[model samples]
Target: MKTHDLTSLLEAMFHQSKEMILFVDRHGEIVYMNAEAEKTLDLSDYDRNQFINICGHCMGMAASGDPDCTTCFLMSKEKLTFQVYMRTRYGKRVTYIANFQQIDPENNISVFTLNPLSELMKQQEFEHQKLLTQRIIQAQENERKRISRDLHDGVTQELLNVLLEMRLFKYTKDREELDEKIEDSEEMLSHLLDYIRNISVELRPASLDDLGVEAALKTHFKWLQKQYGILVDFNTNLNKKRYRPEIETVIYRIIQEAAFNAVKYSGSDEIMVNLKEAGSYNGIEIHFEIEDEGAGFLMGAEPKGSGLGLFGMHERISSVDGELNIDSEPGRGTKVEGYIPVGERIV
Candidate 1:
């Protein structure tokens, strides 16, 4: 094609392009901008000569607290293509993948093109959520393995030992010896029963399924007191009110994890838990709070444990359309609060 026709075609493409395009001269003046650029930058009303510095349109450069002008790629000699955050006309921050090229090396003229990163950012967020889901599944598997190992090694092995001893009773000749073996067997059987019950409760409390969440939690608190010597002040108004199995399970697990965290790390002798109904007649919700006046760590700092407990709690609560909030500050205390809708008001 002829040079004139080729130039015309190129100009038409540039003018019609959706991507923001700018031509800047050596003096940092925006000599030309396409229709998209004018709309994106909110520069349609401004005189072209007056909009001189590119930095004026960038959030990173214009930020009052942490101006990032020193890292601007335009100052570098090499042709650059990278992501940047810019401020639009309405003061909204927008992400863009920008391409900068020296159009005329002798004249020190450059062309800057920006592709909006909104869609790309959304894709990245989706990938991140997928990774988080995978990690949560892996954590659950690990927990199941640990519980399985405990049951096999501790409970199952002891039961096997009792069975072997019972088999030896058949060969006993002395009545007295047989009586003594019977007594020993009874003692071992009792201990084995307790171990089995403990394991069963750990897997899932029968009280939770048979009785309700309140009873299950009370029993768990009593056990926690015996095991960890930490006192739990549990307050609830449910009065054995039953919910859907999934909701009860999610609430139980969250509170269980929260209480365990307090016992393990809070360093305080007592923790408080509250469960009650909230909202007016139109909308009712169940809210729970676990608070400990103990040694709380920084909110955003690295966790002391595997970090899966809180994450798992969040996942479980979210599954029930509930919201969870954890607040903590070093040397103060920690509080975990959550709530879920229980449908319309019963009263």
Candidate 2:
């Protein structure tokens, strides 16, 4: 672009851009402001010829602390881009992303531009959710791989062995040999059946839909003890209560993941799980917790294992308008707890 055209374009943008643009001196005296700035800010407090107190309109530039004017933006010579809170015509303190740059060194005149913080946050949230959705899809695919491996390595191999044994039964030298082979194959097949059943439960148990969250969890805790020797002390006052299918699934899955994490990482032999109505008068939500007095970790430290399990638990709970909170400290017990609102409660 030619210099003359570039100047015209810049002039048009100064008059057209919706951002609150202002020119101020090093002493924070407002020199010039765009039409947009005049429309948004409450300037009635300051007279036209008076050295303006920009502080009245700007609450403060956000800093590491409480936006304290410790390091005033106007006092600095370097250009800066930061978040700032500014009062508007309606006396509302709205956050704005601000840019301050010295345009005239001799005069100490700087151009300040302000854009609403909400627009940036909305864009960032969209990107974050997009990444999260992709990760969840990957987690589901990994789960499928796990189930497939278990069936192939444990159940399918055992079944194939049984088939080979049956084929050789006709060639058995005597009745005693055939009888012994038959017994051995029967035991092998029985174990394979149990293994398959375990995988099926891990995928999505029918009991969760047929019975409810409480019953499903009881069976799960029992299985955990049987399979991993990790005892789960389960207690519940739900008393055969029922809920919407989706809500029940979310509750069951969140508890399941938490208990599994405790078993895998807690190093403690026992875990306690509590399930009950949360509110005293209304009982409008259900609260469940999985806790273990084990070797807990720092609250913000890196996870011992892949953090996908914890992330998935949060996603599951959030889908049902629930809240999940985790509290743990080194040498202190870890507790994974949450509440699921029960608007779809069924008797």
Candidate with the greatest TM-score versus the true structure: 2
Residues 1-347 of candidate 1: C-alpha lDDT, one tens digit per residue: 54578788889988999998888775556778898988878854345544566766765532334546666657654445577777787768887878778788887888888888887788999998888788778888988998989889888888888888889899999999989988988998899889888888977899998888899999999999999899999999988888888888998999999999999998999999999977856577899999999999898888898687898899899998989999998788899998988774322
Worst 10 residues of 1 by lDDT: 58-67
* Cα RMSDs, all models: 5.3, 3.0
**For model 1, what is the error of residue 283's alpha carbon versus the real structure, in angstroms, after optimal superposition?**
2.6
Q: List the pairs of residues colliding in candidate 1.
A: none
Q: Which stretches of candidate 2 lie over 4 Å from their true place?
A: 1-3, 42-53, 170-174, 283-285, 319-322, 341-347
- What are the runs in model 1 whose C-alpha is more than 4 Å off? 1-23, 27-93, 97-105, 113-115, 119-127, 279-281, 344-347
TM-score of each: 0.76, 0.85
Model 2 scores a C-alpha lDDT of 0.86
lDDT tens digits, residues 1-347, model 2?
54578788877888788998988988788887878988888667555544265676888877664666767788776646798898888878788898888889999898889999999999999998888788778878987898889989998899999999999999998999999999999999999988888888988888998998888999998899988999889889998889999999998988889998888888989999999875646458989989999988898787776577888898899898889999997777799998988875776
Error of 2 at 275 (Å): 1.8
- Candidate with top lDDT is 2
